[model samples]
Target: MGKKKASSHKFLALAAAAAIAVPAVSPAAVSAKEHSFKDVPARYTEAVAYLTNNGITKGLSPSQFGTNVSISRVDAAIQLAAALGIDPQGTYKNAGFKDVPKRGQWAVNALAEKGIISGKAAGLFGAYDAITRNETARLISLAYKLTIDETVKKTPFTDVNAQWAKYVDALVKSGVTEGKTSSRFGADDHLQRGEWALFLYRLAHPAAKELDLTIMHTNDTHAHIENAARKVTAIKEVRKAKPNNVLLDAGDVFSGTLYFNEYLGQADLNFMNLVGYDAMTFGNHEFDLGTKPLANFIAKAKFPFVSANVNFTSDENIKGLVTGGIAAAPKDGSVYDAIIKEVDGEKVGIFGLTTAETVDISSPGAGVMFEDYLEKSKKTVASLEKQGVNKIIALTHIGFKDGGGDNDVTLAKEVEGIDIIVGGHSHDLLKEPVLDTTGKEPTVIVQANEYNKYLGTLDVKFDKNGKVIGHAGKLIEIDAKGEDGTYILEDDPEAAEILATEYKPAIDAKKKTVVGKTAVALNGERADVRTKETNLGNLITDGMLEKAKTINKEAVIAVQNGGGIRASINEGDITLDEVLTVMPFGNALAIMNLTGAEIRAALENSVKEVPGQFGGFLQVSGLKFTYDSSKPVGERVKTVEVKKENGYVPLVDTESYVVATNTFTAKGGDGYSTFGKAYEEGRVSEPGFVDWEMFRDYIQANPNAAPELENRITDINQP
Candidate 1:
């Protein structure tokens, strides 16, 4: 437990100035109900003595302390902040709560800023809610950074659960006042004024030094080297503000733009080296080029790669570079596993875990094996704890679990002792770190928006026992609206030069090469394609269908997960670079034979998270479907029809259909297990073409592909 600094001099100074010892009226000074309570001043003698002695609370009148009356949570917050000598009369803005007044906002913000009291959902402080003993105790313990010394005996609370027991124990062991009951804590009872006074007073008495940790991170950067200069500038500013800090990259620093296409991730390596990344993990995209190119990228990368779960023992090209380290991966000359980093005399244990789904989605090759995520996380944390390192940060590529995959939140719940998770792959823009409510200590998980668009900074504070007490963070925007050249960062001259003289000319040349023309603009925005059908979705899926038809005579359908489409094509001439931007993953074509039942199941999967955009949301061609999104998942599809030579007809469940899609989805990339099963059943084949090339070719073949919302897929319930 961390000791707290006491500001008792304020109380002593007040006493000296007043020239008074205790409050003027002692227990014997006046009769109850007469001068104090107006009902029972004599009934609360000791409670009065404790409050006055600690200088925590003053009675309403000169002789009366409102011992029996309930206290509002907000009022309690103000009192506690005051007891800590933090005046909040008018310092903070809104206090991040809607109901709090500007005048009283600072106190609430102070407590919240320290991670003492978390508001109700939607950032509500519940100012007026009556706080029970258990709730109040938890907040107090958090604010004071109190930990139960295992050696100290328990407080024996009858009401609080095992989860709340340790906190209640800390409250009592602090020698703050004993609970309302000797053996049983009245956990559900409303906190009264006198009890509140005793609690705050005790919390303010301990004295100790504070520990601060600053973690700067990035995720899902996807090879945007131009924005790297700005990212470097942001880090320099952060280093100035916090001398003691760790810089980290959360992976996916590969793929997306021509930078990766031409340099094959080496361009990213040059910029990352200039930025001085402490460590990095292999996002699934890192394996897109199979192992040899990945091995080349790893050999040139200056930073260590960490991931305990991904075992790369098979690919001969990288195996020598990885399995036994050989100066290729993390830990100086070791392969890949957990690494211990020493920053400012603190032993910070770091580990990494990519989602196990990487095997099916990317070309990690048959050699690289991904272990179970939760299992690996648990083992790594235990290993760290055994090393006497309490502070642990998991640099993970396993994103926030929005789709049906193992994610940061699930990892937080299942793993113990992880203080922070710097995650990627989901491309979530977390304004603040997400804390794990289930863990013993706070486990913070954070991810910045993808494509080098935002640089995330997380400031964490740790107590004596190395438990995370509080954290604050924000995602810095990568560039100005609609412009890439203009960024918020002054370039690191070396990184800027690498982008300019080395990579820029090639990318610029390719960008100006016109490939095709479109009559109308494409809607490839995340919200549009992921949640609903768009003209761009129709066009891309048609490209896949046209390409698949050339290989297989029976290929009639093309399916593309909205996630595969990255950018919108404007009306007019479309450049090859623009096509690459629209389909950046370098995903290759795969032809699969799936039964209509499996196809319908895939449709059901697409609409499962309706009203919420899931990357797995299907955008298709040669098929039409109607779904009632308001209905429950698995039962949402109301009707499905397949286009035949004569007309569109109902899909036959028993009959198999020839379908084409990117290799990612064909192998069950984004929660599409139905397609994965078909792939595993030997019904899938690679058609020897990349997604962007195929798209360009199809666009060239058809001068003006339809860019209209044809209502191919719609919600039947919508009017």
Candidate 2:
């Protein structure tokens, strides 16, 4: 919790040369009633009446409050004195000012004697002159004894001078004011009567104590439900400790393990619902299977989703769930640009942003359009502010410092009013909160890595003005183990039952169902597949080629990046689980048009780190290549050949050949810049056949398929 500075001070006046002290009288609590002043704006009505009822002001005539009129120095002193519970009629010695007026003579003289006021000149009090904002700040600070932090060297306001910086800082720190804008104090500007009344009312009634909020967040869970029970326990523990907490997920709950393949996202959604997520944003992977599955998932969700930039208008499936603009009363199983929730009597605003890269990286279909993240974020913040919500959060799936395209770090630096960023996409495990003080107010960014490994917890304290004054964060290891290799935290029984009885049986059965039979062990081991030609790599690429040809018969050659092949297949029966494990990312096959020279450049990149493990190591089908490791990196490929109907022919530099590869590599996953260029040039077409399904079909069609290297990728330097 942020320690609040002392804002309440008694108006103590000494005897003799000093003004007489007055005992404070507690004013009666005012009922909720509208005042007769027609000119007072609704925001300041209560404050204006509170001062009026306390005998501070009778108003200009009966109906007019003169809310915007510049308050003069004498009038300001009288009001400040009466609002401080001082008797303005008390007798006091003359203040020794020649031009002192008779109307507020006693109040001004009493305040001057108390050392709270000083004359504008040696003999002139400037009693009739309009008091400046700087004067108001100093008077309020002294009268209320607002705690001033002397160590603060500078404030957000650049215009405040050395003489009055502390006073202005005191008022801001005490939540009395945030200035006219973030950077401008308007210190020399004249004070309005209504503004001073509001300030005095705040001093009289300090805001409902500073709010301390705790947020438990997760992101990129990606169907890793094995430890979902333990994650539930961790979340429960946090909620037990901090009841004033909210649970949020930053997105990507769709793909990764066999659970998704068998149940789509239902299994993950059950656990998410059980754990009670307050809101979630869509990650790129959420659109992997297109709109129908996503629509079904949202329909069954217990909480709403926030996506400020994703427009679901054209899509009929999920468009009805969307309610654009800020939602004051958000509904469950729906989508909104932003939502406001009252947390512990304080209103907090939350909005979401999905990456624009989703169009190329995932299958959102044509109807689901993604807007520019940065531009949408600015409008979202402004909209939230207009709703009178000062405490705001951005739950985002944009990566953290992911180049410059779209990420959390860039969002924090560019946007001004966002208080906290619960981020994902890059799967960054920020052990501590990253504070961006570059903006007017601080923005705290946190991410809990990926795959349900950790549950991130952030505790933040906001002042009355909704400025983040203090924050602390950490990632709780969901599957933390004891010394004996036993789990440290007990699984939540309900969650465990849901997983064991509800989903695990089908998953186990699916794991055992044989997809195909292989005579020998497919060598997809990390070291072999990444460094040398493996039969598993050859099989995968051949499957990719076969699948690509079914959609586009022009595809002649196929290449699979070694990194996309995750596991080895044992000899004999190949179960469905084995296929999923080997190609777990669910990368779709894409065919790209490439010139022979461009193919040669891609080949050069494929073996650039030859003799060492390169994930981009090309696994070939319908092609052969010879390279000498003794040669330089770019010039390693000695010769390339393309398979014709009869046999292999030397590759023609100027000729174009249709090539097939997983979307990851075709989109430049492992520095395949040549292939990436082809993809960027719109020469690539996605048949959308998932890698594992293609491999499974290819093996099923030829049950006894056992691929062996035919010296397809020969290293001339090898013995």
CA lDDT of each prediction against the hidden true structure = 0.72, 0.81
Question: How much RMSD separates candidate 1 from the native structure?
Answer: 22.1
Which residues of candidate 1, in runs, are more than 4 Å off?
Answer: 1-210, 323-334, 402-404, 480-487, 512-537, 543-575, 578-622, 625-719
Per-model TM-score, in order, reads: 0.53, 0.60
* Residue 433 in model 1: lDDT: 83
lDDT of 1 by residue, 415-445 (tens): 7778899988766668988887675567899
Residue 48 in candidate 2 has what lDDT? Answer: 86
Model 2 alpha-carbon miss at residue 311, Å: 2.3
Number of the predicted model whose lDDT against the real structure is largest: 2
Off by over 4 Å in 2: 1-209, 401-405, 516-521, 525-527, 541-567, 570-573, 581-712
Q: Please write out the lDDT profile of model 2 over residues 234-341, one tens digit for every residue.
A: 999999999888899999888767788888999999988888888899988889889999999999999899999999999989998886666545678899887776
TM for candidate 1 is 0.53
